[model samples]
Target: MTYLCLGLSICVSIPTYISFMYIRTLRLNTRFIIVRNIVLSVCLRDLMFLFTDFVTSLASKPSYLCEVTGALLQYMSTCAFLWMLCASTDIWLKVHFPYFNHANNIYFYRSLSYISPMFIVCATIGGFRSGYVDENSCWLSITSQSMWVFYSTAIVLIVLISIELAMVACKTTQALKNSVQPANIASTKDPKQSRNMAKSFLPLLAVFGITWILGIFLVIGGTIIFDLLFVIVNGLQGFVLFLSQFLFSKQVHNAWTESKERATTRTL
Candidate 1:
């Protein structure tokens, strides 16, 4: 089951990441930029897990390899979470403030998304010395308190993102209501526009929030039922992401259709 899950995640994630890279229209949007990074990070994380946890376990390997893989996994997972937070915060600011400067602060967001996790992983290794890797697996040692660093960081980021998304939802709802009133209808913007804006953030919020929250629980310990649930939901995250970000995206479909039409026109 674990192997199946990992296989599915890698298969889905690699192709999805490649599609995002090749699709010019997808790259033009700031939101897609953040999402691209998220997908990349998750892809790397799953690959590392497959290698260190499954492959290495089958063979005799040095201890340092496990430690190194543990650190890489930690960094990639944290980076994915941070990117999700950035996405939520970006949408929240845009919804609340019409002129939020996402383009200007994109570099800052990217830096935080990537560098912050590196810093955390480095600090954990430095502070704990030999405590980073567990004896039984290529992951943080729960006994040495190193695992909490990742868990605590994840929990905090999840809470902050949830708050930001909740506020965005409330603000969007209020705006939608205001747009419908007779007196405000003339002055208000289109409710459909507001709804579309809200819809854009929902996939990220639902996928990242629910899966990771369940993942944290599964890691901490859970029943067989919960473990199976986690394996299905959390393991197939890449598939879900592909569905939400690409397959169901009208923009991507339009972009692909237009590109094909242009190619055919040139050929004719």
Candidate 2:
């Protein structure tokens, strides 16, 4: 678990840092700004979880330590999901109504997306302070009271993502239908773009799905396999987030290609 956490932190942090420091195009784009927040949220969540686990392991009585770490974990994780929801909704709007004017309101929309999750997290923590360092683990425990908070949020996120995926599919199907007929030479293939967005989004949905599904299953049946899967899925969330950026992000690929070209020119 320690090694997995360390690996996830390194993998997620390096690209996240590079994207902020070096990717000028990504910084300028509103969509990428939402993505950047998601990246930062995932990185912080992973690193904080690692730190809390490490500290809790050493402390004799991790009473206060548990509360602090557990709260942070909840906040950061929930923030990531909310940011993802924002990103998907933005894309859905753009795809379904490409001509809609958003230039003036984009910043306000982005701010709302970023700010709303904090309130949800605060409410959860205040309403139910059930998360604590478990006897065996140094992470948030899914106690009966806290289960609803964590599981309900997770379920909501998954449902939202699933809806976004369906929207993207519809956009893609329409784009493909248009592409098949005699159309203008320069007409944009919206489906291709939607496909890319969906590709990047699916893994994030999968991460949430796997973790929560396994968790729900364990709660219901308490099987060994479900228990093992829950631990594995929970532990590897950071790594999955890191992978999704590379696997699904067209901007990340473009940035990499441009960087490679620059490197080659410098060498020449």
Candidate 3:
């Protein structure tokens, strides 16, 4: 059942990743970039999961693979989560400070995206694989001291995610106020103004807040229940992780819908 669930997620995620990459070329946006990052993160993490799941899948071999792949799994996930933290921060700042966002749209931020992704991956692979293998895959296996490091990093991600979400909320409130200003009547250019300014990016926001909080709590609490609850949460995390990949396609669908509408109206 576990493998079945995971297989289904990969099935959905593979095409979603391909679709997001295609959409990236056509109609890119911050939301798409964020989603794309998450998809890639999952892609890498799932590869580790597949390798490890094999040990768990068949005869509980508990192979010495964790001594090797363990670092990649941890690093990929940490980088994935950390990059997610960065995305939330970037988007929140962008929403609050449009001018700053315009700066990011130029080139440097684009470069950061590429560079930072690989940096996180390598940093993980290099830093965390000392004495981390026990019987199964557990953080304690990383070593006595590393568990603290893991928790500390988790705390950092939580702090960053929290701050960014707060910033975004504040921006939403200010946007609402600006949106309702007395003189800002709904005129011809208002469509563009409203479309650009509303900037809910609600799906992206939900992905940020929901996934982080849920995963953090799971990681923190996993040592306690450590059995049924932990497994269930991990299962759900897999579901949520893969599920977020689908949102990237919504914008593509929106564009297509609008295009079709325009074509129909023109023909009529």
Candidate 4:
């Protein structure tokens, strides 16, 4: 999972960074560009979480060190998913509202996304502290209360992502069905007739959705299994999901390459 997540992070972060760069370089509207930038930032968060997870995964006796690295991992993993929830909410707004225009700046939206999590973090700080460091390994294991917190957070994320995926799927299916012609060669012909925004969205959406869904299950299973094995499988599952997103798509690769070039030029 560690490798998978890191690989996915590299895969996603690079292209997301590039795509935003390309959008900025183009004559795009400020608002649309801002939205894309927000999404790119979320991908960056995912990468950070992946790195943190990879580190924790490598350390010996990870569970014993839940106070330091484990806390960091929890923060990253939780926040990354929350950021994705931001993406879903943003996209859902775009789809549902379509014209509820507001002049709120990018900072406003970004701040909005972080504010809720910050509150939760603050609440958690006082209420649910990791009491005894297991001292076994570098993995994470909060108290049963924290366990519940983590579980709840994971469930919320699963639900939110699932909602986004379902929305995307329904929209895509409808669009494709609408586009199909009557029973003729044209319908199943060599050349395609049309494509909808929903269709264009499916590949990325599927990557995002499927990976997380599969990942959450793995983590749950790991937590239930014997201690040492739990960390291994859970971490592995998270990485798998992360990697799956990037591996299953090509555009993500292109975007990543572009971002690297831009970063290189800046460094030079």
Candidate 1, 1-268: lDDT as tens digits: 7778767878988888787777787776777788788888878887887876664565677788888889989998899889888888777666656554558767988899989888999999998887788857878887788888888898899889878877766766776676553332222265444445447656765766676667677667868877787667666767667777778877778878977888899999
Q: Which pairs of residues collide in model 2?
A: none
Q: Which stretches of candidate 4 lie above 4 Å from their native place?
A: 1-8, 15-19, 22-68, 102-108, 130-139, 171-268
Better of 1 and 3 by lDDT: 1
Give the best candidate by TM-score: 1
| Runs off by more than 4 Å, candidate 3 | 24-27, 55-64, 101-130, 138-143, 177-226, 241-252, 258-268
- For model 2, residues 122-167, the per-residue Cα lDDT tens digits are 7766766655335445455656356467678878887987898787
* lDDT-sorted candidate list, best first: 1, 2, 3, 4
The candidate with the higher lDDT, 1 or 4, is: 1
Report the Cα lDDT for residue 134, model 4. Answer: 28
TM-score of each: 0.87, 0.79, 0.66, 0.55
Q: How close is each model in CA RMSD to the real structure?
A: 3.3, 3.8, 5.7, 8.3
The better-scoring model by lDDT among 3 and 4 is 3
Candidate rank order under TM-score: 1, 2, 3, 4
Task: Give lDDT per model, in order.
Answer: 0.76, 0.68, 0.53, 0.48
45-98 per-residue lDDT for model 3 (tens digits) = 766777765554445453455545655666666655665665665655555454
